[model samples]
Target chain A: MITITLFEMKKIIKSIFFFVMLAFLCVFLIGYYVFVHHQTVPVEKLIVETESMIHMQEQQIQELKRTINNSEDGGNSQLQLDLTVSEQLLSKNQILLKAYQEEDWQAVLQQEIESNEPEVERMKAGNEYYTSTFPTLFTLESRLEYNKWLLSHNITPVLPIDFYSWYTVYDLDFGDPIAEEYIKKQSEKYSSTGVYFLHHTLNLLFTIFGALIFLFLFGDILTKEGLGKNGPIHFLHTQPLSRLKIFIGKLLAVLFLSLFVIVFISGFCLLIGSLFDGFGYFYYPVLIYGEDFSFTFQKMSTVIFQSGVLFIFVLLFSYALLFLFSILTKRTLTAVGLTIVVLYIGIQWGKDTILSSFSPYIPFHYFSITDIVTNTFAASVKNFAFSMSTGCIVLSISTIALLFLSYFLFHLQNKLLH
Target chain B: MIIHIQNVKKRYKKEWVLKGINIKVEQPNIIALVGPNGSGKTTLLNCMTNLLSFHEGTVELVGKKHTDPSLFKEVSFLQDNRILYGNLTGYDHLKFICNVQHLSTARITDVAERVGMSSYLKKRVRNYSLGMKQHLLLAMAIINQPKLLLLDEPLNGLDPTSAITMRNILLELYNEGTTILLSSHNLDEIDRLTNTVYFMKDGAILKESLLDLNMRRYTVSVTDGKKAKKILEEKQIDFTSINENQISFDETTIDLQTFIDYMNQNDIQIYDIDKQKIGAERRYQELFEGAK
Candidate 1:
């Protein structure tokens, strides 16, 4: 079994496809490094966007005043209310722009809290907890607490206090494309450091691209061994080893090599980032989603570590699934294609309402490794079952199931293909 | 018993490729399975080695069931070169066989030398020629010094010298008490290797070993063939006159010594006698007559 596993790994490592995947990772890292300079959105740009908003609000307030002075309209009271709201917004923008210009992040955060606190209070008073902009009290409070945390920690704001969420858009958009782009680019992901670069790559990699890299790399493991009577796999089959050992050997090979590739990417990113910049804080706070719309923060290093653990299992689950399909299809591309289709459908359907109650049971829900760690997908879809522990359990079970099924089919097929 | 395949049956899709095949070998001897294509020769071999599951009956090698993978420690199958990983070197293949069979790593070098593939043993199988691949397959098969060696077309892609080497290696293994079951289309090579031949047509084996009926054919060339032919014809002997100076007949008709004694007493000078072991070839011709 060890020999078979080692031989499989040697075959994979000797393959040009493995090197190609490494090159792609290097290119992503180098490309990020080359373009990271432009990724950071300066506070000056935010200040300018705020000033423009303030100027537009002032013009609206002036127009309201002229209309009030020119005519004694019957609906002047409503117009006056509009005028008051517009004036309040105008003053809020002025204060924010000034704090940004002075680089007083503390004052700016305080100002934002002071301004939004009233709206949150009014919504509570009127029982209007949801809005298009502020969908829930959780969103309002999450952003408010995010700012308070930053203020208490004395960490300057790189992104808005709501955290780097995919669903929230309350950051400094200023109704301008430039401001929106600026807001998206303000994360520490653009920073040149070991922690920052790995975090950034981790966030991007847990998606389909990472799955595909390993899938394509090891996709042909079984098929290349010769499912046919004349295949090289018969060489092993004709040996004294059992079929179960062969399956275990290939399984171990995929798992070990997959872990190697994942770690290699992470280490390579860190090497490039630290070599160029420096080793940044592993304790940098990353937001973690909680039940009941509650939330907490974890260290960046912890997040990455946790993501690695879960992603390893996720890759195992994928390989197991692919191996099962390989036995059925007996062709590399077709097996990979079938696995991707199945995984894709599982991810999509798991997100949908078909069996929403069982989302946590679905292994594909944890496809986004980071999302699972942070409970982002769970909180987004309101299914608290999709946590990291649940992800590990579900994927472990699914992998074992697929492995058993695959081995059964492979055993049955040894004679059929003959 | 080294090989005991009893009433084994195998089907390919809807066709019965092996129908109630039975063979039992209790001693260490080379056995050849010669047949036409699609005559269940390879299928029976596969069934015996458990490479292909039989529909019915039992196959045991060296007292262990074929299904027991440990039987492979005492049994080796020299299949087509497709069983070789093209990306791996011949040395890798030999080393793997040794590892799987729990043999010493020292055997790889020994087997490579014995097969006369030592020079190209370290080269990738993809870079090897057809004969080189055959050598690697042979080396891998014999690396464990198995008690029973099953070879299917082992001489498929070999040069004359390599074929001779393979034959010598098999003979050596036979001398070492290895029981060999060989299946091939080359009757001449089979004849050279073993006298116990099984001829198959369709999905059944021809019942007898043909050893009882397999007689040495004698081609006697005398200085004067006319007198020899006249004497043989006068005695109502069955013979073929190759030319005026030569005549050929099987031992079944008359013992070679008796025929030679008659020629010497009749003042006929026997120039040369070519004795041919045509057991397998003749049986093959008779069994698969008109087969291309």
Candidate 2:
């Protein structure tokens, strides 16, 4: 089995297609970094710009108040309302800016929560001030509430709203709501400028072309031997190895190959990011959906570790599924096509279905493992209760089921041979 | 018994490609399977190697089931050239086989030299000609000196000299106690390699021995064909006239000496005599022609 796996690894690495796709991935990573840099605003620059905007808004509010007071028609009701909202927003921004300047995120979060509570209570009791502001206060109150929860749990409160405007801001036309939400949530959990860039870089890598790259790299793992008029599959079939061993050998080879590519590409991106920006704080906070479906922050290292585990499981499940398809179809393109189509339909459908009650049992729910690890899937999918432990179990079961079915199907593949 | 195939039945869709093929090889020798297209020669070989699933019965190699992985340690199937890996070097292929068979690297060099592929073994199989691929297939089949070797069209694309070399190698392996079951359309080469022939038609095996079918026709070109005909008629011998100057007769029916003596006595000068040997081709025609 080891020998077979070694041979398969050699074949994958020596394949011209693997190297070609790898080259394309490297070029894409560099291009993606450049594009991201162009799109996103630097955190320090954004803070300075926001301070200036706050000062301008304050002056405008004061000027509007004076003009409305001088008006003869009951001080122009709409202008008064605008001044009131602007003054409230200006006070909130000044407090946030002071907290940011002092780096006292806890104090900023406590103050925001304290300031929003009265409005939230008054809105619940039908107050005109909270009602007129409606959705804006509703969004602010939710952020403040979540931040207070983070602070109470001894977690640092990172304001997602502060950086939400810059997350994939220029790449908005991607039109994937889940990806957009993921980018927005990830951007909200800013630690340092460097970590912020790294976070988005990795997120873009996973959300955009990750699945397609996996398909290209591993789609043919099983079917390549059976391709063309003259195939080398017979040689492998005639060897002194069981069908299960052969399947496992190929699976391990693809897994290792994907790992190698992921590591190489990620390292390249990180190096490029560091050269241009810098490596951000290793202890940056990553906000994840907690057990109660509320937002909370975890250490970036822990989130990364969890993402890595989920990423591996996703690869295993996907490749094993593809392996099964390859055995059934004996065509690489067909297998790849079927896998991508099924996954696409599943993800699209899973988002709308009320499967949260049984989401842990549904294997497809775990396919988007990055979303699962980041708890973004919980937010999108109704009734979803995503936990890392449940996700691991679900993926493990699916992966094993896929592999066993693949072996069973592969054992009968001799029927297809002439 | 080196190989025991009993009542093996294989069906493709509604058609039975191999119906009740029961072949038992009790001794180590080269056995040739001859048939026309779609005659189940390849099917039977594939079944024996478990490359194709048979619907019924079983194939036992060296007293173990054919599907058993351990059976392959002593058994090797040299399939068509289409089975070789195109992207890999011939040496890579040989090395893989060698590693699977638990043979050392030295065995690869020895096999390469023996098969006359040492010069091109390092080249990728895609760049190789049909003949080179055949040589590699042969080398792979015999690299481990397997006890039971199944070859499907082992000489498919070989030149005359290469075919002769392959035939000699098979003969050498046969002498060394290797049991070889090879399928080929080259009757003459089969005739040289082995006398045991299994003629397949419509999924049935017709076992035959070339020694039993050793019939020949001797053609004699004479100066006086009329006189030779008269002499043959007087001796009550049967002969067919090729032309006015040449007469041919079955060697089994008439002795060469008796005809030569009679012609000499009749003062007929025999310019040339040729013996056309009856081989697998003739037997194949005799067996399958009626069915066709």
Candidate 3:
């Protein structure tokens, strides 16, 4: 079995097609990295957005002043309080804009906390809640904590520590559109080689092309043995090994080969990231959302590790699907095609259906690795059960079930029964 | 018994490809399976090696069922080049086989040297010629020094020199106490290799031993061949066969020495005596004569 498996791996590694696909992946990654870098919004763009936001606030302040002047109550009316908060917010943005313009890292962190702390405290005190379109108290508080941590460590910020603009809530609605745009810009660079940026890079790659890449790599694992017929499979079959051993050898080959490709991609990403940008903070704060707008914070390292585990499971599950298809179809392209189509349809259909009550039991619902680790997928599907632990279990069970199904089918066609 | 295949039946869809093939090899010798196209020669070999599913009966090799993988420890099948991985070097293939058969790595170099493919052993099979592939396949088959060797068309793409090398290897293996059952269309080479023949036609086999049948056929061409025939007949030397102006027979009818003496005494000037072994081709034509 060891010999067979090693030979199988050698076959895949030696294939010209495999090498070509790998080269293509490298080119694609480089192209994507360059494209993303160009897409990162510059500081000047954020400054303009901030200035326009200040103007909008000024207009709102003028309207509030008029309402305060026309109020029947004395200056102690609700309009007076609204006027005060708006004026304060306007003055704070002016200070933040100046700090940002000067590139004064300390003042920027100080201004962010000074500006957002009052509103957050107000929400905590059961006063008028912070604007519904802004970050939740939990997110703002997490941001404050990340800022405090950075300030204490004397680390200059490469990307904003804003939890509202964190990986999970990257597109969260903000009261000021300019603020939303600014946060999106900060989060767009969340793809560094830093331990903090690992999940983003992984999510970016795996969520989009992980399955397809893996499928293309090993989609013909079984069929390339000439569909287990008169092809080179007979070479192994005529050996001293049993059919079960042959199947196992190929199965293990898929597993090991998948690992090899995954490691290669990761190493490539690491090399690219390390070369361009210094490794970022190891314990960078990553905000994880919970059901009902509740949330918590996990270290970026933990999130990345969890994503790594879940993504591995997802890849193995994909191999199992391809394995079964390769056996059933007995053709490389057909097997790859059917596996992709099946996975696509299964995930699409599973989202609104199984993602609810059956999310923990169904693996397809957990295809979004970053979302699963961050609970954003669960929050989106309204199923809090789509966590990393559940994904591991679900994917393992599904993969094992697929293995059994394929093995049973193989047994039926084996010469033993005949 | 080295190889025991009993009543093995295999069918493809609605047609039976192998109809109750029963072959037992008790002694170490090279056996040739000769048949026309689609006669189930390869299929029968597959059944005996358990490479294909046989619907009925059993196959045993080296005291174990053919289905047992360990049986290959003492058994090897030299199949078509389709079984060769194009991307792997010939050395890689040989080493892999040795590993599986629990043989040492030393066998690869040894076998490569013996098979005379040592020079190109490191080259990928994809770049190998047809004869080179046959060399590699033959090397892989014998790397384990298998007790029973099954070869299907081992000489399909070999030049004369390569074919001779293969025949010599097969003969050497047979002499070394390895039982060989091979199927091929090369009748002259088969005649040179072994006398045991299993003629397969329409999924059944007619096993024949050339030693039992008259292997040698001598054609005597002489001046006045008609008189020679008459004189030989009158001399009570029974003729195995008599053609126009030529007398051809085997030793079964009478001794060659006595017949030559009588012909010489009759003053018949013998011009030529063309000797030939009744190999597979002649027997194959006779077996499948007047039938497509």
Candidate 4:
């Protein structure tokens, strides 16, 4: 086993470095574009711009009041006012300001004072009437408070939040010192504004590219032993050892080195993210949905357990495929190439055949590693009486079958290829 | 018996690669399985080592069934191609095989030194030449001091020195009670080393000759070889000739003595009377020619 592992380690050394560097560069660029520069620049400028606009509106309202008091037409003319359209517009803005200060957008108390034109009067009356009548369920303040609640509770998002649009247009500033600090801390958690599900899907697609890179480089390690024109078949077979041992040793080495490549990429991604954005991630207040949808330790534990189980299953499935390929081809490069082609095709086929429909019933649907990020397919989809039980049964049976196939191919190589 | 093959027959489509071949070998002897290119030698060896499944036969080794995993501990088959991991140094290769073979580090060192590969043990096999690779393979072949060693054309690409070294190593192992079944095309090497030879032709053993003693023979060059042949025939003596001068006959019978006496009487002065040793090459040719 040590001999096999050592060989496998040496084979994957280059791929490990290659993947790690790739992951680092990818994450670094994403962090620099979205978090470090994009997030801070426009947000700060928008805050200042919103404050200036509010002050300018207030000054325009004061100037209109002076005109109304000084002009003879304004003093006695209740029906025909001397106020310009801009002044009336500015007066309407003051009403909006008073409504905002009251932490609501209801009807103004003095609608007749702002305008006597039946059209303007009716518009102001309707606006104020709806505010006083309709119940305010989803306010901006309540939304921010919900976000704070989510972070403290570690609630994952089940729905999208377009905060960038609302924040830009409404100028919903959290000027309260404590609230401001809370908002900044929460904003730092995510560092980007987009739909969670879409964001995750895109992340998975990018990560697929990483997997493809690994796939391309995978076969270089395996075929080097078998594909040489005049290779040392005699040396290996004549060593008074079982062929199975040799096959197993080689398998172990390849798997070990392959894992190292995966870890190197993961570590590099972390390192680049840290370098580019000072090691931070954004948090959002979110509503989670599942079997146990709650902001509790038990829910978090469920996520970890479910995700871990899915991860292991996916890893085993991939390893089994690679093992079968390695034994069948007896050449590392061909095995890797075939594995990639088959897997790439398999994923597409599976998506079309199984995933687009009731794919959760198919055991292979859950055998996807990308599901860890996307969170679409799970062990079971329907909440039937024995759905979970059926899913486990199917998964276990398929996994065992795959393992058997791997061992069978390995045994066949020993018997026939010798 | 260290290795035994009983009526083994292997077929590929309509052709019988090995036809009911029977081989029984004991310890402390170098047995060479010599044959032509497709003469069932490799197939028979593969069957004995359980690498190939014989259609009609049973193979036994050291009282254990060849199909049994326990027998693997006793038999070490040196395959034709030296298959080693590309990245593993020769030293690492030895260590890996030694661990599996249950031999000590000292034993590995000893085998390395015997094969004259101690200097190149630390280098990767990718860097080793064909000769060096052969040495490494030879080292592995004798690693476990196996009771039965199956070598298929072990000296195909070896240099003279390495060949001699390998021959001596096989002899040494034989002395240590290791029975070796070595296959080769070069009949002379087998003739020098092996006690028993299995001469195969057309998928069957044509002859199994136990070479115990060197038969005495003489090659005579006659001035009138055709006349000499007629005289020898009248005298009822056996002789084989080439051209008009050269004649060959075994000197085992007293008929040759009588022929020499008659020759003396007739004053037939023999130009040459060189002693002939029946070599493996001649025996190999005779096996085929006699079959025809």
Candidate 5:
């Protein structure tokens, strides 16, 4: 079995398609870095711009105060309301600028929490506060309340300026407290290094491009042998080894190839990160979600390690599914097409539906390793919680089941070609 | 017994390709499976090697059932050219077989030389001609020196020289106590290689031995063809004339010695006598003539 597995691995390594796909992946990684750098405003530049806006608002507030003093019966009620809102906005901007200057996000969050609580209470007592006067401010107050919830749990806020940039510039929302905590932890750990950038970049890449890469890598593993002109399955089937062993050998070969490509791509990305930016510390914090939808912080190393293991499990499940389909269909294109269709549907429509209800149980739930590790799936989709250990166990069991079924069906089959 | 196939029946869809094939080989020797196209010759060989499923039979090699994983350790099936890996070199295939069979590297070299594939063993199979692929198949079959060798159309794409070489290699393997079950349409090669022939029709074994039929015929070329004809007529012997110089008669119908004596008594001079060997070709014709 080992010999056969080694031979199969050699075949995959020497194949031209494998190398071509790997090359394309590397190129895409580089292009993604370039696009991100072009789109994102540098932290220092954004801070400077925000300070200028704060200064201008302060001048307008002073001028309004002078006009009210000079007016006959003070300013009208509307002018008074505008003055109050502007003063509040100026204070919030001053806190953000101070946080940026000192690089102390926790202090800024504490001050903001202290400042917002009294206002929240005062607004809640006012009749027209939410419906007529300032509905959007109420929404902002709720987010502040969420930040207060994080602080009470001993978690620091990601700086408000960084949060604002992510929301406005990148159009990303950390609306969920759990998501906010994760972004905050990641932001602190990565600190604008290439590793930090790549860490975030890979999270997006895994969600979007993972299925396509898996399809290109393992789509035809079994069917190629059956459908080609040479029909090598005929030779393989006649060997003394059991069909189960043969299937396992091929499965291991696919895994070995996948790991090789992953490791190669990761190494290349790391090299580029080190040259362009610097490698981040291994002790950075990562936030995880529990089965009860509770959030917790874990070390970056542990999260990364768990993510890698879960990634392998997910890939095993996928390859096993493809292998079973390949044998059943006995045609490369049909098997590949079916696999792609199933994956696309699962990724697109599976969340927050009947499938998501079985979170940490169904293999489809574990397809996105990033979501599993970061607990995003649990937060976004109700009744679902992301657990790495559970995902790994579920995926492992399904992979084994799929492999057994594949072997059983393959052994009972007598014909190699149609 | 080296190979025992009992009550084997195979079907494709609703049609029976192998009705009930029962063959037992008590000795290690070359056995030919002769049949026309779609006569289930290939099917029988595949079933015996456990490459195809038989619905109602048991196939055993060296006293072990066909499903036994260890059976292939001592058995090798030489399939058609379609089974060879075209992207891999011929040596890669041979080495793979050797690895699975637990044979030494030296054995691969030896088999390559024996099958006359040493010159192009390093080339990929896609670059090979049909004849070269046939040679590689033969080499793979004998790499392990298996006790039972099953060959399906082993000589399909070989030239005359290569065919002769293949014949000699099979003979050598047989000499070394290997039992070979070969299926082929090349009757002359079959006739040259083995006397034990299994003629199949409609998915069943018809005759095990062609020599046992005892239907040999002889044609004689004589100087006095009219006198010989008159003598044959007087003796109530059946014979057919081949022009004015020759006459043909079944050896079984009239003894050769009696015909020669009658010719001598009637002053007839016999120039030459030839026996019309009823090999596989004639047996096939006689068996399938009515069915066709």
Candidate 6:
């Protein structure tokens, strides 16, 4: 039996159709990441130029203060003019603040042209000067300070000269405490670069495709026992083994293959991310504000283990569903299609009001409780114990329910003398 | 004894598929469960192996009751289509069956060889010709040297040569004390393979004919055509006519010399006398069609 299961696994791996789709998705993911990365470059440069302008304004302020001591109104008009120019620059670049944070730069550049602010034109005029001169003044070390000073002086520079109206008061400086927030947010930039969008779209497409493959391949996995060229019940029930063992063996085999596909997809995503986004882990958080917010291997392994337990429950439930449907229907497709439809409806119901109460009872709900697994509740009496106990209880009940349902269906199939 | 089924009744939707079937097959006997389509042959076979449930009945194979743990170990049911795994090759099917039967791993190769499928063992069962599929099934059935072999339509796709070879193999197995119960549409094949003939129709065994003529003792020697008539008249015996020189008797109890002496006493000159073995095909048709 074990050898048979291993052989089944090998067959799933050798499925050329599966590998072809995976390969296409892998390539598409990589290509999309590359495109997104390229788009991030221009935005990063714009941000860097804005930082340099703030520092330049600061140096000019210091020189003016020195001249003021020498003569009361010395270069004051010139200073005011420069201040006005800086204010104009800040207003011009205000759109970049919202764009940068939201990762919606394309929307801003596309939509900002109708604005009627003086700074939009000033920022447009200052674009070449800021781009060329800011580079000579600011180094890597002085860049942060320059951005801080300009932000304090209300100077925000929007990037890529676009024709958008700019009437609103532009507060370039996020705030004193917000500087840390901005830096933290800035490090994690969102880009709608062609590559990123392409990869995102491809991920959805491939995932849907992969799931469809699994649904079709395994949906009838058990029901095929009934619907093969031979009668399903005849072939399977005739074996010496009990129907329960056969069902379990087959269910485990499919789950094993599904897990393989899931891992394959995850690996493919990582490879794509590596090529395009400089290798960021999806589930693991990299350094954010010098703190490791990542759920590391040690932590993730627990999630994996818990997830494995949850998966067993799901597998059992899926088997039960298929088994019951198989018992009720003639063709394997009917069983499989009904299962997919039920799951779809179940998911939709869980999202809505009527069936949401039964969500805990739904096997699909337990599939993604990793969030619950990772969350460490506060030391309150109800929080920690409730979460932990509920998880374990629900897991136990779901497992038992699945097993019971499967056994009932097995008995039914056996009773069918046909 | 290999199998015993008593008063088994199975129904499919209001129709009784197997109506009170009672059969017992003891060792060293090849028994044919002859029946037509929808006749309870398969149902009874399944009941014996516990593949399907019967509402009322008792079935035992190798001393284990139906649904008993040991039932599967003792019986090998070769269904026409359901007996094989499609994805597996002929070799794989044999090996898997061997493993399931707890037979030696080498029995897979051995059985495949015996079935003359050694060359096609590696070919997938789905890709096999119908004849090849029959061979693979037979290989699996005999892989374990199972105490009781239950084959449903085992000869369905087999060619004449393969069928003869299979019959010979089965007889050899029977000689070694293996009990075989087979179902088939071919009455001729069944007649040759088994002594106990079960004629069935509409889910009931219509009649059973015991083939008692196992020896070659009944020889008809005709001296003169008139003398042959006199011997038949004097002895109160029945003989079937052939040509002018030969005649055959259906009974195996009569001696060849009795006919010769009876003819000689009648002053008839003896020439050539030959006895031919009776084929069971005619007897089988008589048993099935005559009763129906």
Instruction: Specify the highest-TM-score model's number.
Output: 3
TM per prediction: 0.79, 0.76, 0.84, 0.68, 0.77, 0.67
- For each candidate, the DockQ is 0.47, 0.41, 0.60, 0.27, 0.35, 0.32
Off by over 4 Å in 2: A47-198, A205-209, A227-230, A293-296, A379-384, A416-418, B207-277, B289-292
Docking class of 1: acceptable
lDDT of 1: 0.80
* Model 4 lDDT at residue B117: 97
Pitting candidate 2 against candidate 5, the one with the higher lDDT is 2
**TM of chain B, each:** 0.79, 0.78, 0.81, 0.82, 0.81, 0.75
The candidate maximizing DockQ is 3
**Best-to-worst DockQ order:** 3, 1, 2, 5, 6, 4
Name model 5 segments beyond 4 Å from true: A39-44, A47-194, A227-230, A291-294, A344-360, A381-386, A415-418, B212-217, B221-272, B276-292
* lDDT of each residue in B242-281, candidate 2, tens digit only: 8899898877668899888888887888999998776788
**lDDT string, candidate 1, B99-196, tens digits:** 66677999888888898889998888889999999988888888888899999999998989988899999999999999999998877788788878
Task: Please tell me how candidate 3 rates in CAPRI terms.
Answer: medium
lDDT for each residue of candidate 3 in A1-418, tens digit (9 for 90 to 100): 7888998899999989999999998898777667645554445665787799899999999888877777767555577788888998899788877867887778877766776688768777874323344565555655666676666666556544344453334234676877778766656554454343344556776663787878887887888788546789889888888778888898899888877876777777667766776565656656687766566767667887788778889988888888888778788999899888989988887765763565578778768888889887776666788798888989999999999998887766544333
lDDT of candidate 4 over B1-292, digit per residue (tens): 7767788888876688888888776655778887778888887776776656667888888878876755666777776544666456788767766765566878778889999999989887778888888888787778877888888888878888888998899888888889888889877788777747778887888654444325656777766777778888886776777667787777654345675666677767677778757767767777766621
CA RMSD, predictions in order: 6.3, 7.1, 5.4, 10.1, 6.6, 11.5
Give the alpha carbon lDDT tens digit for every residue of B202-281 in model 5.
89888534453336678899998988888888888888888797998877669788888888887788999998676666
Q: After superposing candidate 1 on the true structure, give the runs of residues whose Cα lies further than 4 Å from its correct spot.
A: A41-189, A414-418, B212-214, B218-276, B290-292
- Chain B TM-score against the true chain B, candidate 3: 0.81
Instruction: Decide which is better by lDDT, 2 or 3.
Output: 3
Predicted chain A of model 5: TM-score relative to the true chain A? Answer: 0.72
In model 2, state the lDDT of residue B127.
92
Residue pairs in candidate 5 whose N, alpha carbon or C atoms collide under 3 angstroms: none
In angstroms, give how far residue A138 of model 6 lies from its true place: 34
Q: Positional deviation of B166 in candidate 2, in angstroms?
A: 2.2
